[model samples]
Target: MRWFWKWYLWSEDWKVEGSFPYHLKKMVIIVAPHTHWKDFILGVAVRSAYRFTYVKFLGKQELFKPPFGFIFRWLGGTPVDRRNNNNLVEAVVQKFNDSESLVIALSPEGTRKKVEKLRTGFYHIARQAGVPIMMVGFDFKNHKVIFDEPFMTTENEAADFERITNFYRPIEGKIPEQGLMHF
Candidate 1:
């Protein structure tokens, strides 16, 4: 599978930047410019190419049902009930605390549509879990997946967000118009 994705990415003219930080056991991976469904495919392919089997991603609970449920699970999908007041951050923090090694990826935009601002859940989760946040840019225009260095959160949210915004602002998504255009 890893070789297949390596070949596929090359065949598709896509490039992955930055190496995986294998030293870290637990961290939140924040993927930006998630403006199309194909982003998931690219993410999975990159994960395979890197042989990063510890990675997991949250998805709506509905996606965990029916014919494709097993496939999602096999691809490292963890079902999340977004509708419930589940104290998701705390739950994830507990998961981090209990596990010796885990890496979960999340999209700050939380959707493929254009948003006024990003959802700060990933940051909060990283802060609460006492883990660093790794930023990954899915730049469709450049055909590159750029990974930034792992960042530890400070007391100031605005400053942190400003830094994140600046890092992701230049990356264009598959649907360019729906990409992160603002902080």
Candidate 2:
């Protein structure tokens, strides 16, 4: 069942650089142009393929329900009650500190819709954790998954997002709804 889903849902086009560097033992991965929900499956599939067994990610607290919650939790979903406290950065940083080799995955878009300003949580988390930030490109344009160079947040949201977006400019197949948020 897992193999079937992976074959159908995940991208067939992939380019790996190398094993997650040992120096980057602890890091945050930023997934950009998060214009569609399908990226979740692709992300999980890639993680499994690379044997990246331990990953942590944020999701709305509401999604943590019953059977679905069990599956999500098994796959590293950490529920966040953003409405009560919007300080996900601090919470995620704490999680990093709790784990030996944690890798938190974040979607800068923050949703499956267009947004003018990218969320800055990933930047702050990476900085607070004192770890490198790696880029995971969904490559909707070319139907691929790419692992690019790692970076460290410079606390410059606008410029940093631009640099990250440009790195994915070559990718195609971005959904039309993502147009408004295009860089």
Of the candidates shown, which would achieve the greatest lDDT relative to the real structure?
Answer: 1
Clash pairs, model 1 backbone? none
Model 1 local distance difference test score: 0.90
C-alpha lDDT of all candidate models, in order: 0.90, 0.71
Task: Put down candidate 1 lDDT per residue, 15-109, tens digits, no spaces.
Answer: 88887798999999999899999999999999998888779998878889998899989888988887787888889999999999989998898
lDDT, candidate 1, at 27: 93
Pairs clashing in candidate 2? Answer: 140-172, 141-172, 141-173
Q: List the lowest-lDDT window of 10 residues for candidate 1.
A: 174-183
**Model 2 worst lDDT window (10 residues):** 13-22
**lDDT for residue 116 in candidate 2, whole number 0-100:** 75
- Write candidate 2's Cα lDDT for 10-116 as tens digits: 44655544345445668888776677767787777767766675767777677788858888788898887757656778877887888888877877667767777
Taking all chains together, each candidate's TM-score versus the true structure is 0.96, 0.81
